[model samples]
Target: MSPIPTGRLFRTGTGSDLVLSRTFRASAEDVWASLTETERTARWFGPWEGDAAPGRTVRVQMAFEEGTPWCDLRIEACDPPRRLALSMIDESGAWHLELLLAEADGSTELRLVQHLTTEDGLGETGSGWEYYLDLLVASREGGPRPDFDDYHPAMKAYFEELPARAETPGHVR
Candidate 1:
């Protein structure tokens, strides 16, 4: 079965944010490692190199992507185990992203927000994130990795329709 797209779009002063979240039965600190630590990240997203500090730039290998491109990401904010904000520019465009973590009742929830300049191509963008985040989950669980084909075209329509649905009355974000 195709993965269901769970991202929601919210307008912001700058532009808009496409938000998605996942929950894990792990501490925030553990989840933080999965996001920041090079070895842990390599299991899912990709490994990053260079000193990581607020206002500093780091090179991250897009290990799963074709050609395994490397991109420079500047860290904007870092509040250990709680919040992290970053920005990067590549051929695709400029991307501002934030990851917020909250833990309660022994489970941690990771919320990812991509600050988008325009809503164009949300289908492709949102699907990409869904695939990556699921990869994180699978890596952590040592389960089978998800196929990108299951997410992209399969989820394209759902994400493409999100903006219009958000405008409807009585819509619950």
Candidate 2:
């Protein structure tokens, strides 16, 4: 199967939405709590911290084999289980992840509205989010999870070629 995140890249508005929504057969409580709970977030997303309760700093030291997604981000927003936002210091405000959570069928429909303010190198950002979100889905459902932040050597190849794996041609967004 394809690695993930294989779609045409399009330019968007200043707040153009680059959203990725998925329904997990998991608990809203588990998914929401993990957004800001350091240990939980670390398992599926990176630049981890031991805690995320507001005011305290959460470090996300992300480096992905010079391919997939590469960045070192600092904790920007931590609302825990209900909302969570984080950004790269270098590209602060340029790219952000707004985690919105809602309850459904005794499960959680975690909506990750990842907004990339600009088109410059955002494919990498989206790809990384795509990969990590996969892990989130797996974890939220008690499925197997890949290394969310390790960024092993082969990851770069997957990131570089992700678009090619799409079932449909690139569409304008």
Candidate 3:
């Protein structure tokens, strides 16, 4: 058989839909709790600095193999156990992320869609979202944590690794 195919994880400035979405196995309440609760969020997403309230400005510190990126996180919107929206900035540009939780079977489906404004290199900003969102999946499902925070420079490495891998019949490797 021939080798499978895989899409590049961090193809900067790619895709008309600058969105990297993931639907993992979990419950809406479980996922929602982890995201809204700062203490729980710290265990997975980032630092446990403060609360993630709507209209609240929170500071999230993420570091990678290279350095840390300190960003001003603004909670643009919130809906209990359902949806949470955030707006943040980086060296590239402004990023808008809306995480939604939908009921699927006995479990819940968590989807994260991001909108990168014209500023960060290309509209395909926040290379870390895909990785970090996976982290969220693990955290909500009572699984292990993810490696390598702060996807800035690391994203380049991940981007390189993805395209060369094999892909499943209907899934990306």
Candidate 4:
């Protein structure tokens, strides 16, 4: 099956925001653990260690990536069972990301948003988030983790086309 690129790009104060969301038939607390707790996150994204707070930094390993590259993530905000915002800087540049959770009728919706400063790397960056989010779904629901290869080239066009669509008035796709 092809990877689904269902993210929406919206104009934000900084630049643009790429938002991807998934609704799970699980409690917000459970979903929150998966997102914040190190052991649970290792199943989907990667493992992280360090004191986590609004102004603290944590070292996270990109377990799925080759060489298991590690990066320092600065916690920007933390609202338990609701929202968590973090930032990181690497060779590419600075990245600001947020994870928001809302629960209704025993189901939780997780929204992962990346605040973009430029649209240059949307294709690669968006696809990576899609793949990782799907990995989160699989880890929770019990299934094989998705392969990055399946997401990149296949979902590239869909993400690359988002910026232009966001600019056009009345365009909804």
Model 1: worst 10 consecutive residues (lDDT sum): 164-173
Question: Which model, 2 or 4, shows the larger TM-score?
Answer: 4
lDDT of 4 by residue, 1-173 (tens): 77778788988655888889999999999999999999999999899999888999999999988899999999999999899999999988889999999899989999998888998888888898999999999999899889899998888989999988774223211
Residue 6 in model 3: shift from native, Å?
9.4
Q: Between 2 and 3, whose TM-score is larger? A: 3
Off by over 4 Å in 2: 3-13, 63-80, 91-94, 146-173
| Candidate 3 to truth, TM | 0.64
Q: List residue ranges in candidate 1 displaced over 4 A.
A: 167-173
Q: In candidate 1, residue 64 scores what lDDT?
A: 96
Which numbered prediction scores highest in TM-score against the true structure? 1
Candidate 2, residue 29: the lDDT equals: 72
Better of 1 and 4 by lDDT: 1
Q: Decide which is better by lDDT, 2 or 3.
A: 3
Q: Per-residue error at 150 for model 1, in Å? A: 0.1
Number of the top-ranking candidate, with lDDT as the measure? 1
Q: Against the hidden reference, what TM-scores do the models get?
A: 0.95, 0.62, 0.64, 0.94
Per-residue CA lDDT of model 3 for 1-173, tens digit only, reads: 21111112222333222345556556678768777766676766656465667999888766321375667889999987888888887775667777777778766766665543332343123355655665666676777655544444546544444434423232211
* lDDT (Cα atoms) of all candidates against the true structure: 0.91, 0.56, 0.58, 0.89
Worst 10 residues of 4 by lDDT: 164-173
